[model samples]
Each structure stands twice: as structure tokens, then as C-alpha cells.
Target: MTKFASLKSVRLAGAAAIALLAGAAQAQNSPPGAEMATEAYLRAIQEKNPVLHAVIAVNPHAKADARALDAERKAGKIRSPLHGAPILLKDNIESNDGTATTAGSLALKDNVPGRDAPLVKRLTDAGLVILGKTNLSEWANIRSNHSISGWSAVGGTVRNPYVLDRSACGSSSGSGAAVAAGLAHLAIGTETDGSITCPAAINGLVGLKPTVGLVSRTHIVPISHSQDTAGPMTTTVEDAAKVLTIIAGSDPADPATNDADAHKTDYAKGLSKDALKGVKLAVARFYTGYSPKTDAVFENALKDLRAQGAILVDVKDFDEAPIGKAEGLVLNTELKADMAAYLASTDPTKVKTRTLADLIAFNAAEPKEMVWFGQETFEKAEKTKGLSDPDYLKALADSKRLAGPEGIDRILKETGAAAIIAPTTGPAWTIDPLNGDNYGGSSTTLPAVAGYPHLTVPMGDVTGLPVGLSFIGPAWSEKLLLNLGYAYEQATHHRKPPAFRPTVAP
Candidate 1:
């Protein structure tokens, strides 16, 4: 039997071995129960977070919220699967519970919007406790090309839970690390391209970037409207699915989400261990072979999939189709327009910097924000013509068509497959303040720009670091992806809790 099968047999034997394994798999904090786990996480945040720097603020109301949820449960009122579960939000997502949504920049330190983002509201409505906000890349890594992945003036650097000195990846770095380290059961992370998947892969977590507009973006900080999305980062596929079920729906305020209510469903309801049986999955080989170790892990994952009765088809050199070249222009144009509109909508007294130009000036005046990286992207964005520019319009249209209809859609059509799979990214590299992030090959761009669903599940480890296998599908295919991920997770059980080591052992 395989090692995972042996573990399953051991777990079936009794509670003693299971308890022992659970203790070993507890990462930085043990999970005794929800309440106890919350307390332990809070304690860890106080004791160990100085070095990890994963959390920017702790919710003073977390305990109270948990208590309220407990009372509701005792009264026989279970709200959802995540009822009473403590969840961390990336600091870019606004919440009204006295925590500021800073987006890891000093300029927005006092910019409390005094309301929860609509997606946040959905999570809260499902009885998930807000455990406070975690740090992210400064301005979601858009302010500077040279900016470090996990560093921000407000939150320092978020360390990888598996290796303290390694990069956590960003701009959802803290959310990934915190969930992997057992700081929280779940976290909400925003992604424009690789922000959610990269960090989730490196930190050994399951991340699901839902179809853009599946979750409302209202009151969340802006990026490119075409590609931006908030997703769930969790330790398990089941938890990610549960969170997605709660958060996915249409919001009247966000016009982009008009179709979401029709698409959203109970994503976790039909998960089965035999989900991959007879399923045809196209393998996107573009990102493979970058690292022999990562490639080996991926090969083993393929073996596991085949063992589970999945039919894999190799699709080499998937057409990127000028998507990369056009992506920057679209983002730059939208960043200038979207950011200015968001800032203007905020309370003027609370957000003094009402435009991207104002933010550029604020950063120039603040030495701490520019200590490691300058705002070159911000400067370029400021110089862009308004969204009416023909170049901007053409770039957006071209990028969407290439990445969506003619790219992922074409691949799916040709392969006659339900989804495409690839390595999410290589393992974490050493954190470098002076040099910034050194990311390896990634499969996040096409699905991200296509506004499609992308799910990453921990495939296995390379050396001592973790890697993930991605499942990308057309829009509103979250349910199909989640089912496949859940099957793979059950078969391999590749995810292990982080040890919080100082570094990889030589």
C-alpha cells in the first residue's frame, strides 16, 4: 500500500495513533477545538508573530464574536459549515469591526471605511468569526516592480511558516502563512494574477480564486477590474469549498456580479473520493521541468491521479497569445481609473489621498514606505491617459479575448476535458529585501486574466518546501474544480502542517 493508504489504515485503527499524528501535524499551534484553537492562535500571534510578521492587527472583538456564535449553536441555530470558525482577512478587504483596511501601506493606516466589504458581510452572515486582518504586499504589489513579496511599511515582512527566512509570496502572503501555520482556520485573499495561488502554494495551503465576479468586490481595495478577485485560502479543500459556498453570490452594488447568484451553489455538498474517476483532465506542460524536484513531485501527482482513474492528456506549449504584453497596459490603465474612483468614494476625511496622484505624492513624502522599493509602477500609472484611450481599450479587449476565449477556452475545447492541470508554482525561495521576489514558473496568469476559476491544492513537497498542483477551469466551474481537488487531497494527503523551522536543514 502507499504511504497515504497506510496512514488511512492507521487512522481507522483507533484514536491513539490518530492523536499522535494529529499532534505531529499541528504546525505552530495545536487544534484542540475551535475555542481552544482560537486562544492558542492568539497566543501564538502574541509570542511568535514578531518574527513571522503575518498579522497586521488582532481583532479585539474576536473572542466576543466566537462566544456569540457558540451561544447561537447551543440554541440550535447553526448558520453554516464555517459557523464559529475564526477566519483572517487580508488587510486589503474592509471590515467594520474597528479594524482598518490598510492594504499594507502607511498612507491608508487611518482609512477605515466604516463598513464591511460585501463579501466580508457574506462570510460574517454565515457565522464565521473575523479574527482580524493579515498583512499583504504594499498596494497589492502594484506600487513598485522592485517591491519585496511579503514586505510592507506597516507589517514588515511575512515569513514563510515552513521556513522563517524563505519568501511567503504575495500579495496575499500573510493570509497564506497564517493559515498554513495554524494561526487561523481560513483566510480571505485577493488576487489579480498570482497573488492568491503563489502564496498558497508556497505556504502549503489550498487556495481557490473563484471566477471574477463570483464574489463581490465592492468596498474591497481596487486592482484591475477585469481580473481582480477575492478567494479562500485554507488548510484543506473542504474548508476552502465551505468558505466559497458562503461567499459566492451576486451583490446588487457590484454590477460585475449580476450573474453570480445564478452560478453560486453549495460547492461542498457533493464532494466524493471517487470524483476523478473517468474524468478527462488536460495537462498544461508549459510550467513543468523548471525545477527537476518540482517536476518529480508533479509526476508523482500525475501517478496518483491516474491511480484514481483520471485520464490525463498532455497539451504542450499552451498559447499565451500576446496576453502577457497586453496585460500590463490594461492593468496600468485600470489601476489609475479604479483606484481614483475607490479613493473618491471613501470618506474624504478618512482618506485624504483621493487620487492615485495624491498617493504618489504621499509615498514620496514617507521615507518608510520607500525604504526598500520606489513606486515606479505608480508613476507610470499616473502618467497614463484616462480609460478612454484607444490603446487602453484595445489592450483590455485583446487581453480578455486571448486569455479567455482563444486561450483557456480553446484548450478545453481541443482536449475535450473538464479542466486543465499544472504545477501552481515552484517552492519558496529565500526572502531577499534588497533583491525582491525571485519567483519561478507559475500557471496562474492565463486563468487569472481569463477571469476563470483556479484552484491550487498542496501536491507534495520538494526538499523541505511545499508545492501545489493547479486546476483551472472555465468561468463558474468552481464546483467541478473543488470536487477534483477534494478527490486528490483524499488520495494523497500531501498536505502537512508547517514546522516553523528557522530554515531548511542543510
Candidate 2:
């Protein structure tokens, strides 16, 4: 019994839940370090919160550490904002003793790195407990073009707690949805592109995609060293700031982290409800007007920011020039080399797919894996030369030129903005099995391709689905964007838990 045999197993179970637990709804709403809020439902789903609980250590760790935090509170010491909190960690992040760092693929089942990813260790030291591992898109959704976001061959499908039919968003899907569904107060998510921000946006959680070097990637699964980074996904900007402080630093193991220690602020220290005052922001108009409804939410958010003393500049000069296509080329070329290196270091046995080629073969053998999407992305990557290739070099150069200096940097320099803003993504569309995702434009590509930092706060809602307002800026600007985000979050308070709709009938 791997917990769930199918998605339909809990459809009625979830719907019926809202009916019987009317009174207990508010009772289950316990904050991180608050007194026990009458453990009505949280206890029942402690270990059974399969998709949301990212690690298996939650029970033992939560039991012991939570009490310790409570004792500290009684003794007048609140270790940190997340002092008595529980968090889920993505499968790929290393845990010193308890959980294995498999990246949701069987190839590295025994590849538990025997130490927490440096970022993970810092958070635990700050008093956050590792509850369990949330399933992720296998190899962070790099396996095949047809790959599903939340589905891993080892962990199966991590259903959206809000809707049994809709997607949970990949790579960091579990982490995003877990925190959104209240399985944990926070979770660790890694991203190369839309991995962290996309999921967080769609799931209505706050996600911080730090600059590539801000958080160490050591002991975690590798995507592309140039783009991969770890970040926090939490219910609030304040909590996200707390987690960022604990996890961010330069690591000797990850050379890319050399500049991180000096860059990241105790981000929480600067979070203020009034920091949005007199701030200048530019909106990438090209990324907007995709969905009239999402635009409506974003439009309202603009008004809110203005009311809060922020200036919104409708910058039409921001480039949207075919960046995604170019970035795809670089990802394919780099994934082949980076993933191969990571695979070579892992144990071969017990691994479902070893090399990228082997994984392709496995998917071919199992049609279900190839049914939803094709391995086109993986196949293309296989054909790409190493980063040293002239074509690869050209694509990389063009990306930095267009997405960086000529892109975000150019806009910031011209506007003198504290940050640029956009709709993180449109509202969650109806899940279409035949055609796949039908969402609108996303603001992730620019920041993602540039390896710059991007943070999203709740904007508002569209037919009850959440919309995220993104604040993107140059490297190490996470603190500035976070402060502006915190100010907006505190002022608007747009975040709301999902109602678990079965499907949005179109």
C-alpha cells in the first residue's frame, strides 16, 4: 500500500470534510508558536498528510522539538518566528540522519548524503522540524517533455489539496501545495525556473526565488549550477523572511555561494508593514492583459499599492522577446551534462532510471509515463552539446544579454525602480487531461532566465483561484523586494486557503 491507489480515492472524502468540520475550521487554525489550538484535525492527518508532509521525520521531530519550543516560549525565549513550526522538505534536499535525498527518483534511494543540505541544517538549528518529504517532479521535472509536475515514478501523483483534478505544479509542487493546504507551516523548495515561483503562485502561497547564489545548492540534486537555487515557500511574507534568514549563506561546498553570505540580509529584520511607502515599481505590461480576470485582480492590486504610497510605472519597454525559447536551449544543453554528473555519483541499483538515456528508455517501456507528455524535452537535451559548444555558448550569451542587462537591469536603471512587478501567473484553469495546462502568461521566465531573484505575494483572487503579484529585481535584491512584498501583504491580506473544488466547470 503506497498510501493512495488513485486520485479518486479521496474525492468525496475531501468534499465531505468541509461539511462535517464547520466548527473545527477555526479551531485548526493554529499559528507557529501559539498554544495548542485544540488538535482536532491536525492530529488525524499527522502522518497521513501524505502529499503535504515533505519528510517522514515530522512525527518524532515535531513531538520532541515542538514541546521544546513551547518550553522556550514559557521561559521567555522565542528562538525565531518559526520556533514551534513544522516544515516539509522536498525529497532532493539532504537530511543528516532521517530522510534520504532521492529527488523522488529511485536511482538514488541509498544516496542519502548523511548530512542536511547546508540550508536545511541552518533552518533546523533555528528550531524548525523536518516533518517529512514531499514528492516532487522526478529529477525536478527534467526527465521528459511529457512529464507531470507533481508525479514522480516513486511517489506517484501528489494531488492538489484544493482540487483533486487540478495540478499541484512541479518541481516544488509538493512543497507549494503542502504549505497551502496547511499540512505544514512552511516547506523548502528548489527552482531553476518556474519550479518554486510557479507552484507558489498557482497554489496561492508566497514563494521566494532567491538569486542563484543566495542559497547554497550543496548536497541537493543538481539541475544547472547556473540557475538552480533553494528558497522558502510559506503562508506569509513574514514567515518566508524568517526561513530565508536561516537557510541563506555562502557554503564552501557550493562555490556559487561565495557572494551569498554578504548579500542576504536577516530579511525579516527589514520586513515592515509600511515599507511600501514611497517605493517606485515598474509593471511589465507585456506580461499582463493575458487573462481579463487575472488582470482584474492585478489591476486592483495596483490600486492597493498606490493607496499604500507606492508608485506604479507602466513600463512598456520591458522586453518579452522570445526568451523562453532561448532559455529552453540552454536548459537542455546544461541538463544533459549536469544531470549526468549527478547520476554518476549516485548508487546504480534501486534507481529506477540511471542516465538520462536510461530514464528515456524506462519511460518508453512504461507508456503511462509518456502518455500525458512526450520525452521531447529530454530528447532535445540529449542531442545538445555541452555548454562549451559554440551554439550553447551563443544561446547562453544571448540569454544574459536579453534577459539580464538589456532586460531587467535596463528597465531598473531607466526607471530607478526599487522593483518591477507583474502577475506571477493567471488563475488556475480547469485541468485538461487531453490538452494539458491552459494557464496564462507567467512573469517567471524573465527572472528565471536571468538567474535574478523573483518573489510573489498574493494579489487577489479570480473566481476563488489565487493570483500572485511578483516583485522582481537584480541579484541580492530579495530583501528589498521582500520588504515591499511584506508591506503589500500586510496591507492587502489577499491570501485565503483553497476550498478544494473538484473542478472549475467552464
Candidate 3:
């Protein structure tokens, strides 16, 4: 059996990577050579990642890759605006950089496929350096309902950068924390529901969970094919837009992305501070009032939008109970099928857990895997019938319908709004391993199940823990959502770097 190395032990590899870059010769100062910038980022990760537990493994080849990119830059062949920028990927995203793409699961510690996921390929082709893999909730937080967010057996618990003892939120916990702490220029995070948005909001960054098919899901660890997608988690909305433009294209391997090329555009170019002028936005009243403090922050955010000459309409009558029930069945059914498919695609010798059942048995025998939480959710997924089962098919259809045309679109038509706005989620909660995550209100479900684009920008802080304001639109409306978010972000710059305090006072 392959044993996963400790996160502390992994730091040694990152240290060696920095050491390798220390010898790179042809360094430039104009906009900084890729090698120079990569070395600085590696140093920051080496210094801060130990405390934050945000990085799973640093790309040992990063400096070499940076050197190559610098050579290209010297040849006057720039790739994109993000040329030479170092970006971190959530651990689930595969790359051929020698680091294993563990979903923070010991079962996949040796699952180094030596191939880049389609999105990673796009990033590297555009001259972005693959910095490292960020830790995530084990199996993207689907192991159990009682499982703790940001806690993984392989990488330990990812500490929130703002209030170290609070939840960073996952399974994009490390990506959010890493970028918030300035460990990377940008990070890629995948979301099924609130993974990207919650973490980015709580960590004081911008998170975009694009429409389901807008980005390729090939080679990623799977939960549900219907809802999974990789998106940008960055400190600025423009950075998110820049990343989206590069990664949003059709992948032959992913049939869902067949229409992606048609919808893809230069998202960053569409951003303008005047994008919101005269635009009417539907306020998702249904998603507010979870936290009084969060509501207060949201009210101020609305005022900011109003000050920008925008009309806000309150949309209060939306029920999520049926959608929640339907989504549960759909996710469970897809998990059993999709996990098996992803496992089969892995190197058989390296990954022995080839099926959901195998994973369940492996977890039962692995003491550390169960130390923080049980695999009750896995058990539930295992019991689910195949995808062709009528119950599951019905659930999938109903979920998409109720959350899409009948939900978000209906609200938009009735309110005459360009997009819907709400509090992304409440502030970070205290990290309680024994009790698990106490998540508050979230506006992730409607857009998530609907396969619509959702963007979360830093709104403000509550007791020093940051929160985000959400901008949601119909499917393939990523460009519109990004522009709206950019406008708001410019009008009220609420994002700030984390203080890294041990805890926040009540």
C-alpha cells in the first residue's frame, strides 16, 4: 500500500524547489522574469504554507518551467496578460509536474497521472507557471455530512488566513487561503455547491463558479458531473475574468463543454466600472438574514450598488427545500458512477481503490482517514442505484428544472433584473473538528443546480472575518456576471489582505 507523506514532510520538497530556482541565471527585472517571480512565490509558500496548511505540494519543476517561460519572453513571444504569473491549483486538478493530484485523500497519494488536466494545459500554454497544488477537504468534502471543512487526512486542516482558528471553507479551502495570504497570483478551485464561493468570500478573495459546462471537468476528481467545474479564486475580479477567458473553451473529452467554445469570450475586456449603471439587479432576499451582521454588510453593499446608479429589487419568495432533496439524490447517484469512472482512468498500479466500494473498505481500515469523520456519505452513495434509475433521473431532471428556468429565470423575468445579487454566505465560523462545520445561509444552490454562473466578490467583514456579495445570472452569463461584479468591486473596494491572527474575539 502506498502511504501519503505528511504535509510537514512535503515542505522539504518545496524548499528544494526554491533552492533549485536560487541558481537560475538569466533573471530579468522588466515586469520581473518568470524565474524571479516564481522563486519569490515559492519563498512565500515556504514561509506561510506551514502555518496555513494551504499548499499540498509545490511543483518541483516550477523554476525550470519559469526559466523556459522567461526565455520565451526574451524572444519577444508573450503568451497572454497572465504570462509568467504563478498560479496554484486545488489538489484535485492533475498536472504532470511530479506532484501527485491527491484530493487530500490518502487513497490517491500516489495517484500521479503525469498528465495535465485540460484546464491546466490551457494555463501552461498561456505561460502561467503551475506553482503547486493546494489542499482540499478530503474527496472534496463528500465523505460525510459530519465531516469537517478544510480537514483532510493527507494535508491536515487548512487554517483560515484572516482568523486562523476559523473555517476557511472547502473543498477549495487551500486555494482561498493561499491566494488570500498572497502565496500565489491566482488559484483554481472547483465547486459543486458552495466550495469556491464560500471559501473565496470568507478568505477575502473573488471566486467564480462558472456555468457547469463553461470549463472542462476532465481528469478532475469527481463528485457529480452535472455540477462540478473549475473556476478562478483570486484577490481581484479582473483576475478571475482573465482566468475564465483562458480556461473556458471546448474539450473533446468533456461532452458537456461542446458548447463552451461558442460561449467563451474575453471576459476581462468586458469589465467596466460603468457596467452596473442603470442595470437592475434582483436582491435574493431569500438568501439573506441568516446572520444579522452579514445582513448589515449586505445592506451596505446594496447602498454601494445604488450609489452607482443601479436599481435593486427584492426577490423574497423562493423555496429551496425541494431543490435540496432532488440535488441530494442526483449527487449521490452520480458520485457512485463518476468516482468509479475517474478511478478507472487513474494508473491502476498506483491507485488501488478503483471503485466506491473499494474506497469505503480502504477508509474503514485506514485509522487516520476516519479520525476526524466517518464515511457515512460514502455509504449512502454506495447504496444508491445506477444513474439510469428512475428516482435518480427524476431527481436530476427536477433539480435542473426547478433551479433553472422556473427558478432563476423566473425571478429575473418577474423582477426585470439583469442579474441577481445576495450575500454569498455568512462570515467564517469557528473551526470545530469535533462538531464539524456550522455553515450559515448560502445562495449557491439555485445557481449551482441550475448550471448558471455565480460570482462572489469581497463585500466586507463581520467581526474581522470577511464575507462576499454574490452576482448570479442565467447559463453562459459569466461575462455579464463578471462585468457586474467588477463594477461593484471597483465602486467599493472591500477586499483586504488577511491579518493572520490566531483567533477573532466575539
Candidate 4:
């Protein structure tokens, strides 16, 4: 659950981490006389304010890495910040070692790969140890509209660390819950849209939705080539920056990058404590004025920012989301094609159903999957032609024009600000098995559709269920946003772990 190697790599890539090591040369830097051992990390989990074993302990090797990290720290030769950090990746991502890479379905339960995903490689190269894979919504939560967030056939349902009765949110559900519960310091999460941020927001952690190509999607399972991305989910902006610096890079395997004008770098430099000083920003009040309780929290946050000298501008003109409709069309057209292609690349000899149509048939044969939620999204997708379809081509064109030029670009140009801020989402509602998520306000659809980077920080709490405040900007604005988020996090210090109550009595 910890990202020790990434923690160490923070210094490896940034000025601060190395400086710490430089000043304290020949001395163990984990903590002042800290015990670096498998026992300590396990004890941390054992004594977690809220237990998080279900999401992480299934990975058998997590303990071994903890021991190694402890040994290295004792020897005064820690590999990186995330070296001994126990990290649980979503099951969809490939793990070269012993961890299984099932995408939350029994179908791919044994679909282990021969190599670690490119993102995993970057993390490990930076000294991150792969503890094991955490559970997720089956197939990245793309199956059913009625599908509960965080419920996977393989992992069952991931309960919110705060209130167990509430939905943990989906796809990256385990990552958010595990990190918030102190099972690990950080986790790597993927998102086509709300997967990462939703879980993180509701779990009281930071979620970064990197620009489409900021991190590699080479070995992870896919939904849309246009929107699929991997990012850091952590307790603090500093921690997210620590891991992001390593994973943000160009990858040849993911050709969508050829057209991407993304800014990839060690984004941790933006973690300055005073980043909000005199920084110009716009608040999309449209994303606000949702929940009365959330409004109170947002106003308080605004007061804090104003006091901190963030030149705030009120923006009410943006109901426009770039590539808005185009994004949906793009996903539908791209999914069938991209998924089929990806399925073909896997170890076909072992896979039962490769095509989306095959999956539909399997679901029909097994009533449990199709009883309530059906793959209507998949059926719609399967009916569409390849990326060459005139509709898809137009949608792609519309996406660029709207989400990029008319959307984020226009806003930045009008405000002349470094970034835009809004309510990431409203309060977490009661989890309903008979129904799906009770989402209130969501600001993810904009930057998410534009293929731009977005970072959401836990601004404050709402009725005890965590709600996040979102900050977004043009591509590669990760550093600027990170600095702002870090400054706010340090200023408010709002993050708190969940209490795991069975339910919140309304």
C-alpha cells in the first residue's frame, strides 16, 4: 500500500528529496530512528485506524518487499522513497512477477503476463516494489449502468474506508480505499473518466488524471485509446508528485501519443508550499452551488485561498465541455476496435472470450451478470464501425476543436489564469445495491474528455463523506496544478481516514 520507491524517487527526480539525502548522508532517511522492516509496515497496517487487508493482503509478495525495504533502510541504502512502500495496483494493470492481472472478471483470473506494464516498469525503475494487485470494478466499471461502483466478481465489493455502507466508487476503488486507510502511502490508478477521482474524492485522497499520454497505457487493459490513462492516488499532493515524476513519459507502444502535445516531466517541482501566492485562477461557480453543505465547504476554501493571495476570478460562462458529445462517440467507436485489438495481443491461447461479442454471449449464458446490468454500452459499441467511420472521424475532430480549442484553451485565454478550479464532486451518497451511484456534481467530464490533465484534492468533508475540490488546466499543467494543490493541502490539512461505519443514518 506504500509507495516507498516513489518516495525515494521523489528526491531522485526533484530538488527536495535529493537535498534531504545530501544533508543527511550516511544516515537512514525513512524517519528519525524509524524501524524499517516488514514488521513495521505490517504493524502499520495491523494497527491501521481502519483495516484495509481485503484490498491489499491478497498479494503474497507485499510482505517480502516490506522486509527488503526495512533491511535497506537499516543499511542506510534505501533504494527510493517507494522502494519498500507496499503498492497495490488495480487488477487490470499487468504485473510481470507473481501477481495476477485479472480485470476483475473470472475470465482473466489466470491471465498473468510475462512482463510488467510500462508504468509499473517506470515505478519499479524508480525503486517502487509491486506489493500486489488490488480489486476493481469488473472491466474498469464499463459493463453496466446499474453496476455498483467497486463491485467486482473477483474482489466482490470494496467498501468505503470511511463508511462501509457507502460506495467506494469504481474501477480504482481499492486503490483509493487502501491508500485512505493507511494500507499504503500511495497507489497507481487508471481512469477513462471518473474512476480515479471519484474513488479518491469519496475516500479523502488526492487523484490526478494525467493527460491522456502523460503515462503509458501499454500493458494495462483498455476502454478507449482517447481517454484511458494512469495516474497517482495519494494522501497528499507531495506524495502524488513523488510518483508522477517517474511515470510521466512518452511511450512508443501507445501511438495515440504521436498526436498528443503533452508536457511530460518530473511534475513534483510544483509542490512548493507557497504556490498559491499571487497565482491567478478561475472558479467555475457552475460546478459549485450543488450541495448546501458542499457550498459551505467551497466558500471556506475560497476564503482560505483569497487570504493566501490566489487571484480568484468567477467564471460562469462555461457550460461548454470540449469534445463533449464527441467524447461519447469517440469511446463508443474506439472501444470496440481498441478492445478487440488489445484482446488479440494478449495470450489468446488461455483467454476464453476475446471479442466483445463473445463477452456478450458469455453474459447471456450466465444470467448473474446480465440479470440487472446488461452490456448495452458494449452492444452500442460493437454496432459501430472502426475508427475510420465518418462519425468517429467527425467526433475526433469535434473533440479536438471543442475540448481543446473551444473548451480549455478558450477558458485559459479568457481568464489569463494559470489554472481553473471547481468542486471535484459533491458529497458521497448512500450505497444502493438496487440502484447505482447517487452522484451530485462532477467536474471530471471536462478535462477528462479533453484528454487534459486534472488533479482533485480533498478540500474538506461533507456530512463525514469526503468530497474533493478539482483543479484543471491545459495539457502538462500538472506542475502548476500540483503546486496549487500542495499549497492548499498544506494550508487546510483536510485529509482524514475513514471510520468504516456500516452506514450513515440520514
lDDT of 4 by residue, 1-506 (tens): 25332322322222233233334335664442211323333444445423332363345565565455556666777555555454668888887777667777766766767778888888767656565677677788877766877776667777786776777786798888877765555688999988888888889999999888878899888898888999999888887988888777777898766544356656775467788999989888878766878878988889988888899998886665444567778888878887787778778776777888887777778765664466777788888888889989988888767777788778888998888888887776776767776766678877878888899999889778888888899987788888899899888989875666666786
Lowest lDDT sum, 10 consecutive residues, model 3, at 1-10
Best by TM-score: 3
How many clashes would you count in candidate 4? 26
Displacement of the residue 239 alpha carbon in candidate 1, Å: 0.6
lDDT of 2 by residue, 95-123 (tens): 77556776866556666555677887887
Which candidate has the top score in lDDT?
3
Instruction: Estimate candidate 4's RMSD in Å.
Output: 5.5
Decoy 4 TM-score against native: 0.89
lDDT of 2: 0.74
| lDDT score for residue 57 of model 4 | 34
Against the unseen true structure, what C-alpha lDDT does each candidate score? 0.86, 0.74, 0.89, 0.74
lDDT, candidate 1, 1-506, per-residue tens:
13222322222232232232234233313332345445656765665577779999998888777667666665556677666677899999999999888999888999877899999999889887888999889899999888899898999999997888899999999999888766677899999999999999999999999999999999988988999999999988988998999999998888889999999999989999999999999999887877779999999999999999999999989667489889998898899999998898788878899999999999999999889989999999988898899998999899889999998999999999999999999999999888887877799999988999999999999877999999999999999999999999999999987766777758
Which of the predicted structures, 1 or 4, would earn the higher lDDT when compared with the native? Answer: 1
Over the stretch 2-60, how does candidate 3's per-residue lDDT look in tens digits? 11124223334433443333233233334335776687778778877878899999999
From the highest TM-score down, the ranking of the candidates is 3, 1, 4, 2
Report residue 481 deviation for candidate 4 (angstroms): 0.5
Segments of candidate 2 deviating more than 4 angstroms: 1-79, 108-111, 348-354, 366-368
Alpha-carbon RMSD to native, per candidate = 5.8, 5.8, 5.3, 5.5
Tell me each candidate's TM-score: 0.93, 0.86, 0.94, 0.89
